[model samples]
Target: MGDYLVRAIGYNGQVRAFATRTTETVGEAQRRHNTWPVVSAALGRSMTAAVMMGAMLKGEDKLTVKIEGNGPIGPMIIDADAKGDVRGYVTNGQVHFDLNEYGKLDVRAGVGTEGFMTVVKDLGLRDMFSGQTPIVSGEIAEDFTYYFATSEQVPSSVGLGVLVNPDNSILAAGGFILQIMPGCEEETIESIEKHLSTIEPVSKMIEKGMTPEQILEAVLGEEGNVQILSTMPIRFQCQCSKERFGAAILGLGVKEIQDMIEEQGEIETQCHFCLQTYDFSEAELQGLIDEINA
Candidate 1:
């Protein structure tokens, strides 16, 4: 099935749950950024979690997740919105290393532990909501779990995993988040911890053809209560274009555009998001100047 996420509530609102299959989403990002095995694991895990987090919002609200780890992979960035739109890139996409002793992708080596993950949320307000925390674990799922429990003060369990192929491509990618709401019972909390301790890694479950619903079931158990909220598609969609680049030049003011016109007769800007280049011809630059002065 095409990649998508399922949002649900469990135990009659005592918990909020999210699960997603991000293979295709991560695949698209791999193609766009040309990421290798280690970087793919890091980026895929972040994207999977970001998609689930995006599903937590309402219309026109969005968020950005940034991991500035001091590892070979450089920075890992992800963006997501309530409409299921998401995109991201890694600065050094070709980073790779030997698998960890657990025979898994060395995401820790790719995304070192000496950095931070910061989230910027746009809730359609004058000022965006943001949170930042140090990278407690280079393994993204734990870091995000820490982010929620500490930064947001919400008890959460994050299971994010990405299996990489021998040829440095994504094999499987997915994750889930189970959050405890206010007034949760002590028994409910113990049940969740027990399930997490025994449950398989989220990526392994995805490879076994588990749907988002099934993933949630794995976490909540057959006897557990789950209320489906909504489902949404997920993919790599970059909202970058030449027109947006032109507007950026306008923001630079008339003199900057004029300097470009005089120096090179034209200018080209490349988007870091999609790596797509935008060129403004001399005439276009002149028009931008006119618009700026107007």
Candidate 2:
């Protein structure tokens, strides 16, 4: 199924929930980055959660999530917009490790235990909203949950999962976030916690053909009244292009362009998100140099 996410309200608006299916999106990132199993799981989980959070905003709004850990996988960085477009990259996407004691991907080992997870939201305001917290666990879900509670001061439950194929490709990837809004009843909080602990991993549910709505239903229960707000397609999208990159070269000044023309005869630039490379001929570099001088 295609990647998508939904936002909804349950229990008469006291509980806000989000769910997403990101298998294809994660698969694309895995192939582009050539990440190993553990690295794929760690990065995929954060991208899944970031894309869903991006859905919480209005037009033109965007958010950036950063996982600065001291592990072999290095830092994880993701950018998502209100339109369900997201792109991310890891400092070390080729890190791998043996399965954990539970036989799952060693996300904790790949992500490291000492670091911080931060989210910066650009709401098109004078000051962007920012939240951050030390890593409670290198497991992405718990870390996100802690970020919400400690930084945003919102009580929330997060479940993020990514299942890797035997060959290190992404098999399934998805997650959910259920936040208790102000004035939520005690019973509602208890009910959600009870159900969350028993549900299967989010990736497993997505692998079983469950939609985003189904994931919410499983978490909120089949009986609760859930009102869907919006549904949007989610994918691995990067906003980098040759023209934009050309502008970057112009920023390096005219002499640098001349230096490149002398040294390499051409220039090559690569996008980290998709790993796509762009080449400019010597003439093109000369043109940029003229523009920079002008």
lDDT of each: 0.89, 0.91
Show model 1 residue runs off by greater than 4 Å.
none
State each candidate's clash count. 0, 0
49-95 per-residue lDDT for model 1 (tens digits): 99888988899999999999889888878899998888988899987
Residue 177 CA displacement from its true place in model 2, Å: 0.6
Assess candidate 2 and give its lDDT.
Answer: 0.91
Candidate 1's error at 182, in angstroms? 0.8
lDDT of 1 at 39: 86
Task: Provide TM-scores for the models.
Answer: 0.97, 0.96
Q: Which tens-of-lDDT digit does each residue in 243-267 have in candidate 2?
A: 9899999999988889999999997
Residue 222, model 2: lDDT of 65
